[model samples]
Target: MSGAVPLNDPRFQTDPVELYRELRRDHGAVAPILLDGDIPAWLVIGYRELHQVTGDPALYSRDSVLWNQWDNVPDDWPLLPMIGRGETSIIHTTNGQHRERAAMISDALEAVDPFTLRQHAERLADELIDSFCADGRTDIIGRYTMLLPVRVLARLLGFTDEQGPGLVTALNEMLDGGEDALTGHGHLVEAATALLTEKADGPGADVVSRMLANRGDFTVEEITKDLLMIMVAGHQPTADWIGNTLRLMLTDDRFAASLSGGRHSVGEAMTEVLWEDTPTQNVPGRWATRDTNLGNRRIRAGDLLILGVAAANFDPQIRTDSSVLTGGNTAFFSFGHGEHRCPFPAQEIAEVIARTGIEVLLDRLPDIDLAVPGEALAQRPSPWLRGLTSLPVIFSPAPALSPARRP
Candidate 1:
């Protein structure tokens, strides 16, 4: 549990939730660490502590990156940066700026409404599953889970299917740190350029096109970057949630039975999966801007901070019982917390994935099971992310067992 593991190791490549559980049990909430000769920081793993840190912007700041502000200003900082001395986007902005941007974004999302999107989500879900139902088996991560959100996000942003593959690839590359030139907001800059140059008007009702049509409120630059932010933030978490939920069901049919039982069970199952295996395992890294108390620790300026959403979701202290993570309990850290919480678009997307997508998948596929035993499935290696790189499931078209005994 202590030694460094290769990123591509089978253990790391499969069962990310188990790895997170192992790490939390071994490391605790405020674990000490030294990484690559850099300043050591505490990785907060408990649910209560992670919630506290994320909610309080006064002590911990999300803008941890040290921009080069020598004689010349860093290219990253904006002319009228919203927070602190240098300008940054809402995600990295702290306190007031973060709240203001969140309000704007939330208002936009609310205006879209869940009732309207459900029909579209259902249609998309139908198309995606129809292609694979005949195969009798598939990798949920690659074919099913990853594909739909990108499409939904593209549709929401006004991008065409023609542009979906490239945009998704670019976003993943950015997340994996493959291209140094696109670090931080530079990634957003690159994505926006691609959309503007190629898909700006080709043909689609993506979020980008919507923003362009509603140009009165946002600047071209702001529209471009915010769309990029949605692309980057929206797809992965939803994709991972869908994929991980399938993984959970394949491993335990009881959970699947419960989900398939009715509408209420579907919502309960989604919450349970989030608590058991949250899609976003690691919170964005925060830095202490000034000396402050987090729980009992004395955190000082420049000290790196990590809120372990995965760990916190499973915290026995808050959960009161571990099984609650996989089956019960209502409150959770699935979408994150407070100022740095995930955009509320997350709730609708999650509900869609849970009730519509997952329920239908389970109903259509019978006797489905993991290709590898649950223990053998691989996990993504990063401590900051929780997801399966691949989930191979065997599927068959058959009616579920009697409803009375199911679940």
Candidate 2:
């Protein structure tokens, strides 16, 4: 309710982090911003506010009911049905049906033993390292880090390597809000259609097929969308975290040296990376279902509520000091909090990404260093996510390690 921030303002587009910092300082925890050409919404930054919103389903609804409030907005806007649909999966769905569906999915994901995941994660690490070892110079984002999780998820979902490219491309396009902002759903729909109709064959086990056989409570359509969501959400954030963590390690040499010293050190290093650079920078959105009090202010029924997970993660009150978060800590809001928290599978996946990912990179390319100055790197400009379009790094000791022999 203070100085209004137009989403088009250069600050909104360029430096969202700094913008959030200022908003937190000046506008209190909850501030409103108009994004997508004046679609009114509130941005919530204070940890207390986000916790309150995420914890209460009755007061603050994630259901698509919020979309109906935006009657002036076009029918085709991407977020419309999403809000109306409400928590479709465990992430945001609030309705009992969606919760049941999520429970089923959770049961399925939980069925996969932790030891099995560890073994698979080890194999995945080996394969990714193999690809990058030959040249010792590869784009970790595109070539290795990103590919591994997709491979694992595909195998889990019963997808193929051949399907990887299209699925990955579709996911990127769908998420980037590119090529189909109006519909914001073509890529996922296409992939889901193909996947849903495909025959189950081949020597590998498929998560989708498993779900098909024992889809506790999800409809075929819901199952497919949930699978797609899992695939997209599972990998990209982990890849970004891996990349960001690597950059952090290279940025602070002493930290890297300490991390490389031993196995336990790797855990510490992962914690540091998480704290320093959370993979997903955007907080999920929520809407006020009725008039409510948030941090001493009156929130109307129709007002948009923004959860600034990034800002909350950096809040001085929760953290010991802002300076320490610079290295990567698990305490960050890159994931989320409360009842609307991310799925258990996603958390396990992140653990795999952090642990196995860091081990592989260090074991294989121990001498890898940032090729450019940290300040010179270009970060992507989306308030919903934080990542580099491309990160250029150079491996020292020349020829680097061979693929077969890489750690």
Candidate 3:
């Protein structure tokens, strides 16, 4: 632990893949690290190591209450929002209770009509494009990618369209792990509470209503917390997936054919992004339930283990040919792995939203190209999630599609 790295090091925000390589070389799979405020923890960067950690729920638990550093953590710590404790949400639950909660969530999400989901995605994408189509130039991140997922998700979750913007603001601020994180969390809780109250009297054909109808015997507070979990888990990562995939399609020559009309490669580009530039870079994390060994590091009971998702994807042991395209290879840890991995239904929903949004953008603006050099593009400054701050692009001006013409 002599050269323990700080997780908040600026290098992690910019060019993290290289930093991951350095960490892997210097510390092997499990490296001693410091979270914000110099609190010690371990980062599991090896692909095999990460798989083992996530697969064994009994050994490496999701229950943050088991963390040994809580006593030293200040009440005002900015990271408290990201590393929450004593929450009754599905993310913190274990054993039989966790299974019940997970079943409720999966059932609700699985019931989403696939055709309607695509329709919502396409219509929302078209509406966003209509806002900027006449200008011939726009920052796709701020104007489109960042807004579309939350808007589409809001509609599916029974929130009014007017509520979408505020939700986006709060979700981003909370996920950014900054000074306003706690405040952002407060806004989300307030919004969820109000929405659940409204849904109680009158259920609808939405995820929230469906969860309410589930026979889980969940209380208002429990459902509200789970709703917040779903919103936070569903929004930003999907947005980043669209952004990263679009960036890949624009910058990489392999996908250049799609920019001109060959849309067949869109799925391939998206899959590649999962292996290369996943949205959820580093997840926080599994706590060691007892003394154990991982990747040559001795982990003590209650030790924090941060999942190095992006790092594991780049692990040389598994990725023997780093230069080779990851065509159809879905083994990457982006959506996570094992028992607590993202639900299959939720994964399907994210894919529909992202893939539909990308396809709609390409169909609407076939000639779009990056306005700035690809190297000039910068990433958002957060170690936990990886995405662009903005993706400026230009295309020939076109008239907006009339409402009659919209599908």
Candidate 4:
């Protein structure tokens, strides 16, 4: 009735749905689990209970300062990269301060015109697709998915050529999470430090510039960390979301048929991906502010709480199948909820990027098919995120989109 499963266990990473589903069925929604360091945490897997925990900050808080494990866990614990963090993390902040920081980001994102966003998305997608479209076979991960998000984020942030790659690499390293995580985090801080320095001198019409001007009383160091959080949030998961959605389009028969029937919108397909294969399987950790109960499980003070985003989507508490009905499915935990909800609709952003890239490429090369069988496809081994390392596909060589469509 009570036990712990290793968060980094191979099956949890490689085949999470089946693995966590069993955890939900057997462990009853909230399963105490072990992180990489044998550190303890609770994994919330049921839809209703996850909502209960996430929506009520009075009971569950993201303030990492409340986390009790720090007393027992080492300062250099690997889980710190993903779970707990400094005072500046927008993702880990709460309530009024959370709203303040989120507003700064939301206002900056709102400044980017929809038309201009799409125009840049299409141009970037077209150019990248063209580079590999001629090869007749390509790895979508490198050529398209991984690069598209960073490119768009760079333009939105007003990053120069040098700054773009620096941000991307640093962000990737942080999320990639291994022996180099501390180094990667150092690089991210360095990149953010430089950007903050540049913006302070002579601010431009960009997200960073806007954030700097709008920040109420955030110190420069705090603003730098906030920017790093925004950059990583904007690019990494969205890139993975696109890749997961693209793979669904290629492999799922029902999804593939929708393209021929003209029955599915990019948003619809993207929603389905989020339901079945959320980009973030587990998300920013929450700590119980006081002793509480969640789905019959006693949550003690300072206990770590992780919403099983992917598990909640499929939990019997909600019907995922109803997504096929007309109006579209809204029941998803991919973007999270409550005071900490992602201000920008990540799916909408992913849709904008994926639609342009997928549509432009599909229009040019219509017959692209997976080079390997669907069964051969495998997700990379990370407990917190679901993503394909690559989706190899073959298609008849087609001429690149014309300059008019491209630029």
| Tens-digit per-residue lDDT, 153-222, candidate 2 | 7766666667776666665555554335324356656666577678333323555666666766566667
User: Order the candidates by TM-score, highest first — what do you get?
Assistant: 3, 4, 2, 1
Q: Which residue ranges in model 1 land beyond 4 Å of their true spot? A: 1-28, 34-39, 65-87, 177-188, 194-206, 209-219, 256-264, 324-328, 397-407
Residue-level lDDT tens digits of model 1 in 1-407: 13423232344345544755665666556655432223245667777788778877766777746322222434343221212233355677666656666666655555565664665565666666667767777787777777777776666655666666766666554554322324534545666766755555573444454445544544666656566667667777777777777777656655656544543455655676788777766554677777777756676676667566776776767766675334555578877777677776657765674466676566666465777777766655444456777888776744333334322
**How big is the positional error of residue 367 in model 4, measured in Å on the Cα after superposition?**
0.9
Candidate closest to the true structure, highest lDDT: 3
TM-score for candidate 1, residues paired by index: 0.78
**Candidate lDDT (C-alpha), each:** 0.61, 0.64, 0.91, 0.78
**For model 3, what is the error of residue 363's alpha carbon versus the real structure, in angstroms, after optimal superposition?**
0.6
Tens-place lDDT per residue, model 3, 1-407, is 57999887878767787898899889999988998888999999999999999999999999999999998899888788778876778888888888999999999999999899999888888999999999999999999999999998998899999999999999988888888888999999999999998988899899999999994677989999999988988999999999999999999998999888668999999999999999998898889999998988889999999999999999999998877898789999999898888999999999999999999999998999999999988888776888899999999999999997787
All-Cα superposition RMSD per candidate? 6.6, 3.4, 0.9, 2.2
TM-score of each prediction: 0.78, 0.86, 0.98, 0.94
Candidate 4 vs. true structure, TM-score = 0.94
Error of 1 at 274 (Å): 1.0
Candidate 4 residue spans exceeding 4 A from truth = 258-265, 320-327, 345-347, 402-404
Residue pairs with backbone overlap in model 3? none
Query: How would the candidate models be sorted by lDDT, starting from the highest?
Result: 3, 4, 2, 1
